[model samples]
Each structure stands twice: as structure tokens, then as C-alpha cells.
Target: MNELFDQFDEFEDDLWGPIADDAMEPVADLSVGSAYQAPVEWNGIFTSPSEENNAYLPDVEPMDQTDLSSIQSLDSGELQPENMAESFFIEYPVFDPENADLEQIVGDPAQDMENWHMQSTQSSCALVSQEFILDKVLGRDVTEEELTSVATDAGWYTPGGGTPMNEMGRILEHFECQVDYDINCTMDDLSAKLEQGESILVALDSDEIWNTGADLDDILSEYFGMPGQDANHAVQVIGIDYSDQGSPKVILNDPGSPDGSGVMIPADKFMDAWEDSNHFMVSSGASQVSDQMIGNYYDRYGTWYYDDGTPERYNWDTGYY
Candidate 1:
């Protein structure tokens, strides 16, 4: 995790850009609304030489400007820990266009204690970020030998699953997520892997993920300073993709991916690419994981430690203390 943040620090300027006005509020100020947009003027007239006549043409007026105060101007620098707002927010896309549904992918599961939110989203809180999720799901934090051992263990592949792989898959399915398993397998293999009430990990591509900007590529290039293909920095991949292929895409699910709507990485590049960020993982318990694996989960992450030598907070967001 330190290594991952070090990567963040190394490319801090490129990813987030320089911190514009140092403000600490994790949540963007929603008071004023998005940038002030001018209102459209109806019945405006324009003289067109092409018309070859002095005619009163209906001029299309610009729209009224919105209150810019509510909407904060985002940049790469905003990814910094110190500058992160008090409450992060992200708008999830409609994964199932056929279904025409849209919702926020990441949030406090405590709000919904029943349903998949309780078992899947709630239990894997540590996987809020793409990097952490990938590390744990793929066992990236573990070495190649460890991964191989776990993959070939056969214990991970049996029915009525109890292995971490099976358990993680069930957790991911709540979000309709998929990931490249330690050992390559097809749809059938994945389906068979599930237990009576198990799920599959969602493998998200960076392009499909949503960001502050209308285009996700722009956001990745600007704020995070990481390229769209940088899979090493696995943030939580969110959003629903409904097409011939179901892709759960999202912004890098870092501590800064607003409201926990994390970013996505291509399954093919998800593992090798994000390694460029020097990622790591931290896990605990039978059915509970903090949103942050170990790095920056929230504002006070990495600041205080517990008497039992446990960390009081995690820095999944990478917000400065």
C-alpha cells in the first residue's frame, strides 16, 4: 500500500495536477450547483446574408448560467489526500441500458443491511478501491508462487465453495462485477465456481467507468495522471455495462473516486498494468473488510493506531491528514 501511494506521490502532479486552492471537504460543495450556464434565449433574431434579405430570424439564445459555487472545478490535484472533500460522491451509470437503470455504485452498506448489500458490498468494504479489490480478488498482494499455490490448490475450485476466490466472487456479483481469476477460466468455469449463494468478481475496463468529466478517458489522463491502460493502480471498478458483453466499468476506485464510485481497468491489463503503481493489500476477518485495504480509506487514515496495534483508520482515498 505504501508502494502504491508512493506511485501516487510520484505522479501526483500528472494525475491530479497541482492542488489549485487547498480546500478540505471531500464532498464537493453542492450549494451553488454546476458551473453557471447561460440560459437559452428564445425569439432572438439574426440577419443572415445567405438569406439575401433583412428577415427577422429567430435567434437561439444561450442558456442561463448556473450557480458555479455548487459545482467545484475538478483537476488532477484534487486526487490528493489533503484536498479531498469531506464527502465524496460519484454517479453510477446505467449498466443495463436494456433495463434502463442507473444508481450510485459505491456507498456505506450500513444504509442497507439486508439483501446483497449486506453480504457482498458490506463484507468487502476493504475492496472499495480498484487496486485493493484486484489485489485481494486476484491475490495480487501474494507473490506469483502464492497465487499459483492458491490457484492449483483445488480447494479453491471445489463446489459448495469456501475458498477466498469463491467468497470474493459472491461479494463482487452484487455489483455485477467480473475479474480475471488466478487461473484463467471461461464463463462456464465461473458459473460453476459459485456456490448456492455465491457471486463472481466484476472485471471492469477503464473506458466504461464514469468520472467527473463527460468522457472517462479525459478524467484518467488529467486528474489521476495515470493512463487509461495503467492497470497496476487498481481502484474499485463500478457501474453496470449491458450489451452483448457485460462490463462493469468505473473510475479508479481509489480513496478519491468520489463517493466510492471507483474507476475500472481492462481485465487483460488489470493485473500487469496496475503493478506500475506498486500496489499492495491488507485483509481481515470472516465477513468484514474496511473500504480501504490498508492505504487511504478516509480522512484520518494512517494517523492513529489502536492499543491492540491495529490501525484505527485506513487511507483508501489517500486524503492528507
Candidate 2:
């Protein structure tokens, strides 16, 4: 038996000796343009996927925010909300540095986002996202372990495997929040819902969204420039930062990051990563837990109880737009 196993091992090494590396090299470096811009320390939390999955990335059209003529404004000829184009998504405004309120965020980072939870496993982004949302909006003290057990029992998630892209809605519904899924969602759609103080969860490319740095754009210029497929990660959308008028950022509570609370990202880069999933989103009503001891929202057990109600409204004054 030992001699047979040894022979098999020798055959395996000879068959793939040139391809296999004892050190295991990264076949390609996606950040060719700005290797100096993105710090190496962030690579652990912000993964740089191998180029093998490049086939999955799609060509993303440029996002145009220049035309705001259709947007509602304080004007006589302003378009009514109902009259707006379905394609006329409410634009996410760029941050205006001169605004005193915008400058306040430099001191109060917690205004847009306050809390977060990191995933225990690399594949637990979905579950960890669930846990973080439930904890913040519902005040639910549920643990990630508990969420894993419940999600696994329902077959919504595999033990160590990633939750299916379509299964996120089921898990949210199971947790008592109303979920609306969009396979072809856009940033404008997000802006519209967020303005109403709703909770949003998005699945995008962790590497692309994380980029070289949290705020830096991808160094790769090609469509399949970066390695790996999109939608490999999920995060809770808290708000959009329009303080940097030229570079409006998407504020998110990314569960995959070590300290992901209130992570801000450039909108264009966000669109690039999001295009990977066709901008898949699961938008839901925020927790409605009131002062009353019990409320309408149910727990994981499905018992009728009380809890959080509608989420925080998008505040334009504080970069929450």
C-alpha cells in the first residue's frame, strides 16, 4: 500500500511540476497601475483575487451623473416625483466640501454609521451582514453562531460555503424584515430608497470595492483586469457621502473588513464592482423597534413581537444623502 501511494505521488508531481510552485505564486498582479497607492497591510482584509476568475467580469457602462434636469428641485418647472423617468434615478450628489455640515463629519464619523460586526469566516459575509443589521436596527442580541445554525437548518446557507446570491432575501424575510430584491438594481435605485431611510444590502466584488485602498480606484484598466468574479462579498449600506462633491462616496458597513464600520467608497469604483452582480441588491424596511415593550416585527423564531421600525432617513446635511 505504501509503495503504491509513493508511486502515485511521484506521478502527480511529474505531471504538473512546472505549473505547481512550492511557494505558490500569484499568477498575476491586478494592481499594476498603482502598486504604491494601495498598502500591503490592507490586502488581508481587502483580498486581491487571482486572475483566474477574470472571465466572470462583465463590461460596465460609464455612469453619468451630469444630467440632473429630470431630478426634482425647488423650482416651478421641477418634475414631480411620480412624473420622473423610471430610468431617471435620483442621483447621489457629490460631496460639497464648503458645506459646514459636511465638514462636521470629520469630527463625527458616527453620524452616518456607528456600529459593525466582522464575519468569523471568509465565507460568512452574508451571515455576518445579517447579524450586523439585526443587531443595530433590531437591537437583537443574536450571535453569528446562532444565525449560522438557523440559516443552515433552512438550507439557506451551507456550513462553510457562501450563501447563494438569491437566498439573501429568504434569510431577511425569515428574520422578519420586508425584503425587495433587484437583480438589475442601480446606484440611482439605491439613492431613491436610501433617501426614504431604508436598509439596503448589496453583493459586489470585495476586491474591486475594496480596491487597492478603501477609497482608491482599481489599477487594472481592462474589463477582466482584476482577478476573481464579482459579488464575492456583501455589505450593509448605511448612507452615501456627498461631501466630496467631485467624488461622492458610498458609505457602507462591510462585514468582511476587520473594522468595517462606516467605510466610504468612491461611487464610480463602487459601480464597477457592483456591475459584476448586475448590481444585485436586497432593500428592506429598517428595524421598527419602538419604545413599547413589544412590536410587530418577529424574531428568528417567528413569534409576533416588538422591535425597530423604519430606518434612518437620508440626511443631506450630514453626508447621509
Candidate 3:
């Protein structure tokens, strides 16, 4: 194998980021009710909202775990070893999504999982983020265990290492999701996608994204005050914080940090970290197109693609395809 690190980002060593062991909870009954959203008004003319077309869900909270009876309090000799979440990956639980609930799964899974801010195990960042995106588009909870198990069985994830940098689309495709993968994506590509209201699963260097000094000991790591050393993290871009257009921050649901959800960092830092893995990314918005539809898209768009892997004649109204 080459000396260069393979592009992957499950969990390296639990060396950086917050560990929220107590926060990992089973995602059942996480669905929320839908309420009617008021329609827009134009020049004193208010459009009516039909029940089927106007319902909007409220802000969803991430999983809240309450079972902590196993934690040991300060006792003279009862000091048990800290509960290590990494131990769960010894044999990853293969969670199958097909058997998952498929009824009325119509809300963003992030709303139910709250961006799934909880930290991920060394081998579950991609799985966790994938769970969120899949569940969001499918409108239900697709457990991480199912994603992990399938990825492992499918050879997308190495036992101790992470996933290949560009297989995210194939994984999504395996689930029949309509996907677009880009190996050399640009910042404008990401911003435009977010503008269209779609979350992106991105691979960036954890060292830059979290500013963790875990890799500094390595001679090749960017000396202090720089990034692009460790290519070991996967996150989902939920939105872009444009409070400062000059230096807009990229908001992400980062699985590497303890409170990984709603994490934000300057766009430049994100881009630099992204460069560690060639700005590889994947976005899946609609369900996989039928074989007939696939034929039509290929016949129309051919093989020409933009930097973001978008077909020139893609139907953006659908997914910035």
C-alpha cells in the first residue's frame, strides 16, 4: 500500500473532539407532528395554504438519552473505568434499513435527531451522518447500526481504517437514493447546494475542522496555526451561516466533535480541510430514479459534468443534480 493515507474518516483514535457517550440513544418514536405554515404575502395579497401543501414541522431536537443508572458516582473503591463509546465498534452492529419503518417517514431526520450532534464512535461518523441524510430525505429514522453493518459487509469501510473518500454516493445508491458525488468540489458548489436547501455529506480533515492538535506530533502535519494534516473526519453540511458574507461560516453536523451538531467554522478553514481529501462530497436529495429515468438523464446530459459533479442539463429544481 502507498504511504499516503487512504481517504477515509470514521473515527481514527478518539484523539480529538468531544465524546458524548451518555448521549447515544436508540432512535425510536423520534417523529414529530406537522403544523400548517402560513403562506407568503405579496403586495397585500395573501396566498392561501392548502392543508397538504402548507404543513411545516417545528425545530427538531437531537436524540436525548436519559438512561444513566450505570454511571458510577465517586465512591472510595467504586471508581469504574469511564464508559468508552469506542468499545462498541469491536463488532459493529449491522443495522439493516430495509426492515426500518417506512410509513409516513416525511420529515427531516435531523429534526428528529437534532442534527445528531452527539459524537460518533471511531467507525461511525460517516454512518451517523449518512443516517441523518437518508432519514431526512426518507422522513424517518435510519439507525446508524444499520448503515455501519451494511457498509462493513459491503467493503465500503475497512475494519480499523475509515471508508474510501468517494464511496458515499455508492452507499447512498445502494439504498436507491438519487445521488451525485464530486471528487474535486468547490466552495461555490457547496454554497449553491445549501442555498437550494439540501444537506451535503462532506469529507474534510478533522484537524482543520476541529482545530485539534492530535496530529501535530507527525512531522508532516502542518506546523502550529495551520491545517491540512489529517484527513479523518466526515460531516454533513446543513447550512451556511452568512451573517458575515466576507467570511461566511459553514454550518455542519459534525460527528467528530462531542456536540457535533450545528457546528460552524469559517468557510476558508472548511475548504482547506476539504482539500485534504480532494474536496470529495456526496449529496442525495430524491429517491433513485427508475432505470428508464436514468436512461433519459444519461441520454440528455451525456457525460459532461461541472466541478460539483452536476450534469450540465441537470434538473436543479430536484437536487442541483
Best by lDDT: 2
Q: Model-by-model lDDT, in order?
A: 0.31, 0.58, 0.54
Higher-lDDT candidate of 2 and 3: 2
State the local distance difference test value for candidate 2: 0.58
Clash count for each candidate, listed in order shown: 85, 17, 10
Q: Order the candidates by lDDT, highest first.
A: 2, 3, 1
Candidate 1: regions farther than 4 A off:
1-82, 85-181, 185-223, 227-231, 235-256, 262-321
RMSD of 3: 23.1
Over the stretch 122-202, how does candidate 2's per-residue lDDT look in tens digits? 567788777666665566455776566556656687654679889876656765577789978776788777776667888
The deviation in Å at residue 16 for candidate 3 is 36
Per-model TM values vs. the true structure: 0.26, 0.53, 0.51
Using TM-score as the measure, the top candidate is 2
Better of 1 and 2 by TM-score: 2
Predicted candidate 1 versus true structure: per-residue lDDT over 1-321, tens digit per residue: 789898877764544433324222132333355321122211121111222111222322223333555566456454443454453334443233234323423221221111111112111222333223333433324222222222222233222222342233432322124433434433233223321112223332222232334444454334433345533212333322222244433223333333443223333344333334332222221223332332323222123423222334222233222
